[model samples]
Target: MLEKNHILTPEKWVKLHADYLYNYTISRINNHEISKDLVQETFFAALNAMKNFEGKASERTWLIAILKRKIIDYYRKINSIKGKAEVRMNFYDDGEHAGEWIEERVPSSWVSEVEKDIENRELGNALEKCISALPEKYEIVFRMKTIEELETEEICKELDISSSNLWVIIHRARLQLRKCMEDNWFKK
Candidate 1:
């Protein structure tokens, strides 16, 4: 059986997906401890059930799906005491001023220099600091989905979270990152 169907290689794939898992959990939920645990859980789950893995989607995508589910289960298990109803992604209310969101300001003179800095060192350091400052869950989720490029369904499954929760987390993560980048990297 092992020789005839030797498709199980979970370890080889874990590294590829760790960054994805990290970002998804951190960015979406803003919980570092949970995100770290979830990343571990995703790899273990993938390894234990390697034989059952379907090749319909990319390997990363499949892992992400599993991780997302794990996250939801975690939240439900922990928060069940409150008995709150599960809803689709929990969106943040737009600012009370109510005008459509406006584009951020960009400096005409510094674009090229800033781009070079980001490619080299300064920008990277700033980004690292900003990401580290985010709540753990949001950081993980954003990193996974945005930087690592996992699909939403994949993330949801991997984390055991609802689509609604995923969406809300993603939105909030992006908003936070945008603000951070604007303040730290763009303005100064």
Candidate 2:
């Protein structure tokens, strides 16, 4: 347990990276078992690749960077199997799977009843409607940045807008969405 420049064993490494792998995979797949397996695979892959690791970043960060690519690869494999339709679940359909992934709901005895009541489809739907109703240009920018997970530079290029325009539209879109959520969704 005490040594200079101790090398981490595989078992020790797995213990360290398990939580991160699980979370990152779940963020992509929303399926726990699959995510767990992917994480296991990621650890082994990282272990094999450790020879090339120059410690440019900490070990945990390196594993996580690997895990992100593995998650992306998982999506690619799932897309190949299921086609693009399943990959692109319509925002209007049942969002139970969507609801399960975000960790917004957790087993808790401590939350107030009022707080519990505020989190539901009524809010999700209202937010969706508000997003749907925005001007097309603004909506495209907001959805690409927030939902589709595009980077700002990519979004600007795709929308043919300046960085400043992107910022303005995103800020306005968020404000409008927030107002809609407050007005139509919040159970006040």
Candidate 3:
């Protein structure tokens, strides 16, 4: 407690920042088990790489950066395994109209109403729920580029995806979120 320039101990980090990391991760991921695993992995990675930590950033920032990369990797791994299959089944069910929304499922325009509703707490909650309901890759890309306001190039680099792929994922995510909000929030 008295040391002027002392580095943070691992025990101190766990006691202090674990909950913060958990909350930060759960807000993005919406999965308790996976969030916990990522937080733990962040700690392990930070510990192993402590030698390279230059202290330019705060400890929390360093750990959170590692955790963010871990989350991206997790999304990539899951997407690689199940993304193509799910995309085929969900978005390409029609033989000749792959990736186009069906007439019945097309989202109604709510841009003007959305501006007003953005200030509403209930709308915020519904938005969170809708974003959480998106597929993992879409959710990750949507959050990174939209809510997190990361640059498109940064998101592409972090996710190891091309710019066009990022745009397509974001487009699909927005469509799904629009439909979800219509059904859950606007309809009611």
Candidate 4:
């Protein structure tokens, strides 16, 4: 059902949609060069598939759909079993409070204050460091599940693991993060 009402203007895409598309891709991919490549790939794919456009959605929406597939494809390529190697464990250094959160009480909410802002920034940095310290597969699984907010089923499919296996990985990843936070973030 290709309606004549919606026509894609490929020539105007760069001027009109480039920034929006780049922002979308960067937010998900987080690498400047890779995001640019993905955006260009999206445009090329859209151009090649222009004939298949059904005109049910706006041009921007259609472009985003193609971009989403490109992102998923990128993840699938990186997480493929052929290239995967045995991951080494880099758990946080052993200490008395191993695998524990040392906070007396969790703050109910962050107030707008300079001290709070500094603390929040430090906490975020510590957490980011701990995440990167995780083993390769654990880091990838944790990021996809928590940061990207992808559905469990989608993550499992992309990682080519069973649902149960995905959960176990997530659980172990959380434990690793907790231990790291205890050593670095909570201690400070």
Question: lDDT values of the candidates?
Answer: 0.68, 0.63, 0.80, 0.74
For candidate 1, the C-alpha RMSD (Å) to the true structure equals 8.5
* Residues 14-66 of candidate 4: C-alpha lDDT, one tens digit per residue: 99888899987665556689889989999999999999998888999999888
What is the alpha-carbon lDDT of model 3 when measured against the actual structure? 0.80
Q: Candidate 4 regions off by >4 Å?
A: 1-4, 81-119, 133-141, 148-162
Ranked by lDDT, top first? 3, 4, 1, 2
Ten-residue segment with the worst summed lDDT in candidate 1? Answer: 83-92
Q: Model 2: per-residue lDDT, tens digit, 79-169?
A: 2553222222123335556524233223223324547765676766777798876654466567778877878997565445689988977
* Candidate 2 residue pairs in clash (backbone atoms < 3 Å): none
Q: Output the number of the TM-score-best candidate.
A: 3
Candidate whose lDDT is highest: 3
Better of 3 and 4 by lDDT: 3
Per-model C-alpha RMSD: 8.5, 13.4, 4.9, 7.4
Q: What tens digits encode model 1's per-residue C-alpha lDDT throughout 31-113?
A: 67878998998888888877787665677777887886787777566545442432222232377634444434222233445
Q: Report the C-alpha lDDT of model 3 over 62-144, residue by residue, as the tens digit.
A: 88889879978887787787645343223556579987666677656654555666689988898989887877878878987
List TM-score per model, in order: 0.48, 0.44, 0.69, 0.65
Give Cα distance to truth, residue 38, candidate 3, Å: 0.9
